[model samples]
Target: MPALKLLKLPPPVTEEWEWQMNASCRDIDGSLFFHPDNERGEAREGRVAAAKRICEGCPVRRECLRYALESGERYGIWGGTTEEERRATRARRRVR
Candidate 1:
């Protein structure tokens, strides 16, 4: 997986509080930067869920997930999708 370093931008200097559930950004081409898990699937899931709580307060979640899937990222949580889900999707695709 690649690295998405843009997600850590000082909370959007311009947007401030504009980031919502539908917000989207390039986020350094959407890579592994957003990954919070160091290999523990359960721990990562918990972290993603915790992050979702933050997204509930965010305005750019939708866009984030969209960018993630679009960029073929099989990493941390994005657009509400988990690494396992992405892996399953890839596995299914391979089966086809």
Candidate 2:
């Protein structure tokens, strides 16, 4: 009989993720970030503001924003920034 060899995979690289573990918005309603069918005007503003307020005190705000921007998130509030805000940020980054 021939001997069989087993293949092994390397462990994934990890960093300190305690910030995400302690995010303030972790328990909040996700609907607050993605509201009624791309709503606009004062109501949208209020919802975004509410979401941002939660993000403001979040320890993982930077990580969240980096993730959203890198992943090209086209909806909802992340890291205290709205879709339009992220769009502008992307444009600015491109210009630089």
Candidate 3:
């Protein structure tokens, strides 16, 4: 069998993203309810979608996302983005 790969959970995320991620997912089963028929493969996508909505209604949402992206946060929820999404974004912005 191909070696079982272990996907890292990313580095420590900022307290703000952590709070938003947890908070948004608190009352709602964001994994399932927030986005209907959400497959695990699209978990990150779901988080991003949910994050936008949460940010729209949040007071310090921009600040939180700014802190996350500027600091190169590589973890759970950051800047209203998932680890994979963030990596892809940064990669594109890299000066080749």
The number of the candidate with the highest lDDT is 2
Error of 1 at 17 (Å): 16
Model 3 TM-score relative to the real fold: 0.42
* Shift in Å, residue 67, candidate 2: 0.6
The per-model lDDT (C-alpha) reads 0.58, 0.86, 0.59
Flag clash pairs in model 2.
Answer: none
Kindly list the per-residue Cα lDDT of model 3 for residues 1-96, writing each as its tens digit.
Answer: 799999988777576456555444356544432333434556746656766665456555566566766788876554456667667877887955
Q: How does residue 80 of candidate 3 score in lDDT? A: 55
lDDT of 2 by residue, 33-63 (tens): 8979758799988888899989988888999
Quick one: best TM-score, which candidate? 2
Clashes of 1: 16
lDDT, residue 52, model 3: 64
Q: How much does candidate 2 score in TM-score? A: 0.76
**Candidate 1 lDDT score at position 1:** 94
Candidate 1 structure, TM-score to reference: 0.44
